[model samples]
Target: MAHLRDQPAGVDGITIDWDAPIRVSDGTVLRADVFRPTEPGDYPVILAMGPYGKGLHLADGYPANWRRMHEAYPEVAHGSTGRYQNWEMADPEKWVPDGYVCVRVDSRGSGRSPGFLDVLTALQARDLYECIEWAGQQEWSNGKVGLLGISYFAANQWQVAALRPPHLAAICVWEGFADHYREGARHGGIACEFVKGAQARQMFTVQYGMGSRGPTDRNTGRPVAGDVDLDDDVLRQNRRDLYAELLARPVNGEFYQERSADLSRIEVPLLSAGNWGGMGLHTRGNVEGFLAAGSELKWLEMHGDTHFNPFYNDRGLGLQKQFFGTFLKGEQNGWLDRPPVELLVRHPGERFEPRFEQEWPIARTEWTEFHLCPETMELRTSPGASGTLSYQPEHEDLRFRLPPAGHDREFTGPAAAKLRISSATADADLFLSLRLYDPQGTEVTFIGSNDPKVPIALGWLRASHRRLDTDRSEPYRPVHSHDSIELLVPGEPVDVDIEIWPTSIVVPAGYVLELGIGGRDYSNQGTEIENAMYPTTGVGPFIHTDPEDRPAEIFGGAVTLHFGPDVTSYLLLPAIPAP
Candidate 1:
């Protein structure tokens, strides 16, 4: 049963239906909150379904992110009361007045809804598809629905859209990853600790049945989790142990296949907005989604900023309205006349200039290779004399630097590194970092997705999972197959290809580019930001520090780099020419 309420005459002029029951195929009743215009007319719908509690206000649920976002861009809260602002979802106050109904639903077992909690599975996608159909049949709906949100909300859109829901018109995937195996739980076949931290701090806190333990919704003065509280043991039994499952399944098997999206099956209009700073998690998905999706009408937009900033800022909001207005409202807004790709060209001092393009990897990209010379510790155009270098995997890092640029140069798009190496142990893990230094030799870092300081690009790979999917491999991007592992033979050198996520940066005449390779995560002597949830180091929270995943006996051994005429290692870059 829904409890309908009309706003006061002077208030925002929007009506709300709280705790609306949306029955799915299995007779499970999900809960949603619908915000519609008070004028009583049919309008297009913008629906968002996720595990985050719909009633948990942004300030209450994620205080650090909320404060930092507002402080950086005050315009985010300029036009509305900020009461309906939830984590990563659209604001009802902004959408209702623009002739669009905003629908925020609590996924199966979160918030006011009750069921088994399983995040990012086929079951969740089916529930979303049913919710879309339900929204299309509403009396106040104009029979058109659009999907929009950030991170988790955006990631699921790729899965549900593949089902080809009749009412889903368009989707704007803002900083979302599509592959669960590569971008979600593991990177380069090494277990990442991000999922464990996120599950504990973000999901379990607001899970359904928290009752008195959960925060109260400021607007309704009721518990955000639900009306009844369950014991700790019962709550544990209701939800799947996501971290445990990831550790148990180390390869790309049936477990990961069910969570990853089938990009070829998605045929709806798509606008994938990715961030240059989101190297580890968000960048790869957006670029891959834009290229692999079967949609005839698709566009890609890349920007440089904090993950949450660009989605709510004026520039981001404008692009969203222009896209949704043309698709859902049947308006001739000239959106289709624009190019299919938009890039925010990055320059020194955190500046970005927007440019439109015809395709990704910019059709005119010059694929340049910088050969690694171990003898001189430099990246040169030609291979150097045979030399060998060894370092302790657990304690030391090896760096190779390129000479100062003679003129301004721009490197934009995907990158790859091919290395020939040997290990004293059976296996080893490799971490790569591309860094920039100014004329004074000071490192230049950018604001990453979750951290305040980040490198130009980062990549990781466990030596054993070095097999490539040759069919999908490109000159600039190397795709890895994590189905099985092939341990290395002691003192034997093998060639391995590593894929560095997409990035964009302009280097001035005196600036230098350096590549760092090590067996551990990259870090520098920088102060952590006050509002960052994790230490604002180079990699943020996407770290691979699990001892069980990288045992001391196998991974923490002497690693050797062999350079010779027969075994030449090099870095592949996508250098864009000045137009």
Candidate 2:
């Protein structure tokens, strides 16, 4: 194996090898660079293996991500010089001083390694197992290993941890989803628009030298780090394009299970952190992983703000250090004695108020039911005096408005809408938005998983695909089985319950809570805002929309909101207690 040399300067007590080749299964020599204590007899290793090249410097590897982190939370650069910053992973400078070995590996066939690159499939998990075992046996390692990373890295950690590598002690999954088919790549039986652009902008473009790994490195001046012999065809065959591939298998097929982490098999201590703002990819995973994983010593923390900010902020870093110290270092930090769940309830204008709770949904949460009155198209706390309501696609997407009381309203946890509808057509697409309208009747929109324009929190379900997994269903979350599609009769009103993914908001007294039922995605509601673009990945912010699979004739029909007469539609809200 060819060994890469280290830079002379050291940070704290650590020295780093700029580029080192790590051999994986099947004789593939992938690359990783390590930062370890100089006086190391042995130290618990904090390892992250991903598509991001290990040799690539953060200043050069992810200039856009680096710039954004510093701009949002300037304190990241407070104590030390920023040299080892990388995407969605810990800064080596922060960990080395604590006597931890930080190793970053470029996944096989990515970055300097010559082979094929597949993202989070079974092949990648096998390579990760090997990496874990390899780290345990290294001279610099004390044989205990833990995993930490965000997004891509965090997703893979779940997969490999399920394999139960002997040396793998604990894991911190920061906003990583457990079910690939349901949350990531595809949602509501449709492929994600974000992954479609991500492939060209983030994956192959950087691998093939089309994006910000640039034409060459400014510092090394070598042909950037992982420029290999791969072209479009090789990239195509080796890695499955998540967006297109997921579209083919709309059902919960074998493909989804192959990549999904079996939470039942994950037995190590887990710290699952989620962001309130992460709607599509991450929000479900963190909450689901904590609730489902077999780990007896598991904890959950929820925060708000941009996806990447919470991981490095003082609050995030402090929690990370405390958890890792307890599990990895075997310290008596009392972390295990802490509450099982904590939430940073977010207020308007980027304010977060932390609340330590014993369990999710908070025991004191009032599961308030807001019924949808069809005649007035308003949400009310009481069941309507009239019968059920009916609505159809051609009808202006039904909007229900309800005014807040004299006091402000605070809501947290998952939301659900129960609807009774009769569609003239066989199938209907259910698009529900939990919206907030100002006193002037203007819709309030915030940053969403996709759609830079106006977007209130959204939920979707197909009428035919409305079967629930009765065993796992909860009042706040309706767990869809996605097994069979039950076509509705022409004139019969049927009850359909829709799961609105978790959300947090503080509604002022003047604002009104509104729910919109429509057929297709809402895109043109507001002007698009230009968020920061990812320089290294070349992918902009995540974008999502209802794809073309839902034809107008099949989904769009004359629906009747059978209210005032008999049918009743209602929205379920998890109302939080006032502080």
User: Each candidate: what lDDT?
Assistant: 0.89, 0.73
Worst 10 residues of 2 by lDDT: 534-543
Which ranges in model 2 have alpha carbons more than 4 Å from their true place? 1-6, 9-13, 55-65, 208-227, 385-396, 438-456, 487-492, 522-548, 564-568
Which predicted model would earn the best TM-score?
A: 1
Work out candidate 2's RMSD over C-alphas.
3.6
Per-residue error (Å), model 2, residue 472: 1.3
Return the TM-score for candidate 1, rounded to 2 decimals.
Answer: 0.98
Candidate 2 per-residue lDDT over residues 1-579, each given as its tens digit: 223233454546677664566677688886677888888578999999887655456666556556766888998887657666766778888888888989888787566555666678798899889888888999988898989988778888889989999999999999888888777865665455766666665566546332343444343344433655455565567665676677677678788888889888999899999876677676888988888889999999987666677888877889988998998899998897899998877655556678788887777889999887655667788766665445556456878888657778889888898887778777777777777767787766554322223343667777787888899998679988876668878777778888887777788778888888876554443433334442111112333344365566666667765654355567999898886
lDDT of candidate 2 at residue 382, scale 0 to 100: 79
Which runs in model 1 stand beyond 4 Å of their true positions?
1-10
For candidate 1, which ten residues in a row score worst on lDDT? 1-10
